[model samples]
Target: MVTLEQVKHQCRIDHNDEDTLLLGYVAAARDHVQRYLDRTIYDVAVPSEDPDGVLDNASIDQATLMLVGHWYAHRESVSETSMNEVPMGVTSLLAPYRHIGI
Candidate 1:
């Protein structure tokens, strides 16, 4: 996986700096959403008769947007300033889902 900083570096000399970085971040965040859902729903919710249906209603894309919205909304509230903060936010956002256990 490519780091956000590395992507930003690649896009630094481009004409659209902020947009490029933002797009990369969005893609990375959405990928995180997919991986998180896959892990929490399939791998973690094991031994169940119907795990797929359990997560069928999950909308990773929408959830990713919400996560990004919340990040921008409360950027100041999050004490951590590093890139790890995004994944940390993702974990917190998905905490409620983890307890579902299919």
Candidate 2:
């Protein structure tokens, strides 16, 4: 799982005032990335020192960051958009992780 600190850092936030809001964005991004890749990317049991567990993949990390940034930037928008829609960069980053079952 991506910690609030990580997301805040990615977002370049230096205060704790919006910690609760940022946490929600991080969770939403994690779930979005997981669904896009059709696999669990966060909170998996692994013997690594990183608390994010299986989120060691750089592409996945970037994707999540992109998502968080998007959500943060678009928070006040009233336009209707698909929740599953993500930026092109994020989609490209997640492409390799996508599952293609026969």
Candidate 3:
């Protein structure tokens, strides 16, 4: 999971005033990645009987970071774009984690 501090560092935000905003972005990025992968990255509320299905892959981490950065940078924009509209760097990072099954 990408931490708020890491995102903040990537964004070069050296103050706590935007901590709440940054946190929301982190969560959105995680959820975005989860949706893109069509799977959960953390084991949250799954049944204990089922094996924990957390994915700790570096690609997911990087993708989440890329997403957080993009959203943070474009927060002021008011336009709707497809999820695939993300930058190529983010898309490439997430390509390996994409679900290929129908």
- lDDT tens digits by residue: candidate 2, 18-78: 9888888887888888777666664445555533334447788778888888788788757
Poorly placed runs, candidate 1 (over 4 Å): 1-17, 39-58, 72-102
Ranking by lDDT: 3, 2, 1
Candidates' C-alpha lDDT: 0.50, 0.74, 0.75
Report the C-alpha lDDT of model 3 over 1-102, residue by residue, as the tens digit: 788888988898989999998999988888887777666666345455535244557777888888788888888667575454645677788777666565
- lDDT assessment of candidate 2: 0.74
Question: Residue 52: error of model 2 in Å?
Answer: 19
Query: What TM-score does candidate 2 get on C-alpha atoms?
Result: 0.71
lDDT of 1: 0.50
- Model 3 lDDT-worst window of ten: 43-52
For all the candidates, what are their Cα RMSDs to the real structure?
9.6, 5.5, 4.3
Q: Candidate 3: which stretches are off by over 4 Å?
A: 43-54, 78-88
Q: What TM-score would each prediction reach against the true structure?
A: 0.36, 0.71, 0.75
